[model samples]
Target: MKLNMVLDNKKTILVLALVLLSFIGIGSLLPEELTLQRWVAAFFAANALVAMALTFVLSTRLEILETIFRGLDRVYKAHRWAGMWSVFSIFMHWWLVPQSETPRDESSLMEIGSDTGEWATWLLLALVVISFMRILPYHLWRWSHRLMGLVFFVSVFHYLFAVRPFQLFSPAGIAMNVTAIVGLAAWWYYAFGKSTSKHHLAKVQNVKKENGVVSFEAKPLQGRPTWNAGQFAFISVLHHEKIAKEPHPFTIASSQHQGVARFSVAGLGDYTKTLYDHLSNGDMVRLDMPYGRFKLNRSSSPQIWMGSGIGITPFVAWLQELNYTGALTSKSCPNVVLYYLVKNAEAAIFAEELQQLTENLPSVTLKIVYSEEGRITPERIADDLNGNVDNAELYFCGNPEVRKAMQEGLESLGMPKNNTHYELFDFRGAI
Candidate 1:
C-alpha cells in the first residue's frame, strides 16, 4: 500500500524475475535463426539504455535534485562506474548481435556514429574525459564539467529517437523510454525552469572573525525554511557580480533561535578568499534552501563526529542544534563525541565556544588533534575510541583522503558499516 512497501527488496526481486521472463518470451517470438545469445545481448542492451541514463544522472548528482542544484558537493565514485557499465552494455549489444539474421534497420554499428546517435556518443565521450581528467587545471575542469547537463539532454534524445526497439520490438521499451523522458523532464523543470527570476537572500547582518575563520550572519528576505542539523545552504551576496548567482554550500553555524543564519567560512580559493576582505553588513544576498542527508536526525544511535579542517561545518551545525534544543545539557541526550583534526591551534575555529559547550555537556566530548604538531595514525582513532566504537555511530565530514582513512580506521576498529556516514565537500575524484 505504501510506496516503500511496494518498492521493497522482494518487489525488486519480483520485477527482475518478470524482466527475465519477458526476455525469454521475446526470444521465443523471434525467428529460430536468432540464437539465444543474441536475444540476451539485445535484452541487456535495452536494459542498459535506462541504466546508463540513470548512471549519468546519478554521477552528475541529478537524482538528488535539491542537493546538487543547491550546490551540495557529495557525489560518489560509484556514480561514474555505473555510467561506464551503461556504455559497456550499449557496446555489447552492438557487438553480440547475430550478423546474418540481424534486422536491416537496427543491426548496423555505423548507426551509432550517425546523426541520431552522434550527440549521445559525443556527450558520453565528453563526460568520460571530464570525469577522468582530474590532473587538468581546476578552472578547465570546472568549465568542462558544466557541459555534463548538455550531454545528459543529448543522451536522452538519443535514447528516444535513435533506439527504435521501443516501436519495433517491445512494449516494455516504450514504457522505459516514457519513464526516462518523464523523469528527466521533471528534474529539468525543478532545477531550472520553475524559478520566478527573483532571489531570496535578505541581508548580511554581521561579520565576525574568530580563530582565523570569518563568520557571516544573514537574515532571509523571504522567511527561512525549517532546516535539520548538519544541513547546508547555498549562499550568494548581492551586487558582487563575480560571485552572484554562483551558490556555494556553507554549513549553518548559528543557533536557529537567533532568527538569523550564520556561515563560518575559511578563506579558500577564488570565492571564499574575499569573505572578510570585501563582505559588509546590510548587504542583501540570495540563500538557497538547505540540502544534505548528513544529519543526526537520520540515525538514532549515539554519534562519533569526525571533523578535519573546515569540514567541521556540519558538526558545528549539529552542536548548534543541540545547544538550541537544550539537549547539550540534558543527561538523557545521546553521547556525541567530536574528534576535530586541525593543522594547529590557530586554525581551530570557535575554540572558546566549543570548549564552553564541551564543559557544559557531560554527554559531549571534544578531542582536538593537531596533525602538524602530532601524528594522527589509525591507531590514534582506536586509542581515542577507548573500547566503545563498535557500538557508536560514525559521521565524518572532511577531505576525501581523510574521510577514506577514517572510514578504514573505524571499520578496522569493528565499527558497523551501516553506522558510518560521511559528507564530501568537493567531489573532484568522484564521478
Candidate 2:
C-alpha cells in the first residue's frame, strides 16, 4: 500500500484512540481499588460502551467525515467492525459481570437499573445476531435496527444506578451517560427525521432508455452543490411511496458544468425495476448533496481507469470534465488505459459514448471486453500497462468480489496496493 493510504487510515485510528483513552481515564478516577474481577469487568464494559457509541456517531451521514475516511464505504467498514466489537464485548460483560458484582445495599431503584441493564444487554446481543445471521427481510432488519435507541434509553438508567465507577456520576459515569444520550438522539434523528426540504428538490426533465439501463436527467428545484466528476447523490422519488422514503445512491454521470444531473439505472433490483414504467418526465424527486472522494487521481499518477457494468458511470463523468489533451487532474496527463467490461453487446449500455470519448481524446485508449471474452485478470492489466505497473495508480469500480480479486492480482503484479482506489456502489450490505 502507498504511504498515503496508510496515513489516510490513521485519522480514523486517532479518533478511536482518543475515545478509548477517555474511557480508561474515567474508569481510573474511581477511588476504590479494583479487584482482578472488577478490573476485567471495567475493561470489557468500557470497550462495549465505546464501540456502541462509535456505531451511532459514524451513522450521522455527514459528508465531511466521508471525505475524512476517503469514502462512505470505509466509514461503513468501520461501523461494521465497531458493531462486531460491541457484540463481543457485550457478550463478555454478560458472562463476567455477575461474578464481579459485589453485594450492595438493597434499593428498589438500583434493582430496577440492574435488571434493565442485564436485559438490555441481551437485547443488544440478539440484534447483532439477527444482523449477522440475516434471519429477517431487509426492510424488517432496518426497522429492528432502530430498536437500539429504545434499548439505549433503558440502559442509560443502568449506567447511572448499577454500573460501577459509572454509578458514582464520576468522569467515566458522566461520559457513559453522555455517550448513551447522544447515541439515542442520533438514532432518533436518523430513523425518524423526515425533513427533506434541505435536500435539493429535483424534477425529472427526461428519461432515456437503452438496453437494460435507463438514463435520467433532472434540474434541481433549488441551487445544488457544485460537485466534481466521480461523485454521487442520494435519490428518492416521492411518488414511489413504498420505497421513496428510502434514498438510493447513484453515481452522477454528467459533468459538473452541465445544467442538469444525470444517472444511469440498471434494472437489477426491486426498486430499480419499477423505474422503467414509473419514472417519467416532470416527476418529483429529492437529491442529497454529492458525496465521494474518487476524483481525477490528483495525488497519484493514475495510468489505468477500469470499470465494469454500471461502475463505468464515474469514469464517464470524469471524461466529460477533461480538456482537449484528456487532461483532468492537477498534474500533467498520463496515458490512461480504459477498460469497460460487460456481459454482452446489450450490456454495453454506454458503448457509443465511450467510443466517441476515446476517439476524441488522444491520450486515452478504450478497450471493451464482453464477459465471455475473458475475465480481466491481473496479467491483462500488467500487460496493458506496458512496464508502467510500478507507479501506475488504478481507479476501479465493480462488484466487490471482482474488486477483491483485481486488487490481490494487482499487488502480486507489482502495482502498489494503495494505488487501487474505488467507491462502493454495493447496497446489499446497507441497512
Q: What TM-score fits each model?
A: 0.74, 0.88
Write the residue-wise lDDT of candidate 1 on 312-412 in tens digits: 87777777666656654442445777888898888887566677766756678898888888857657666666776776677787777877777788778
lDDT of each: 0.62, 0.75
**What is candidate 1's local distance difference test score?**
0.62
**True lDDT of residue 318, candidate 1:** 72
Evaluated at residue 316, the lDDT of candidate 1 is: 74
lDDT of 2 by residue, 256-329 (tens): 76667899988788777777656888888888857778887533354788888988998898877764324544
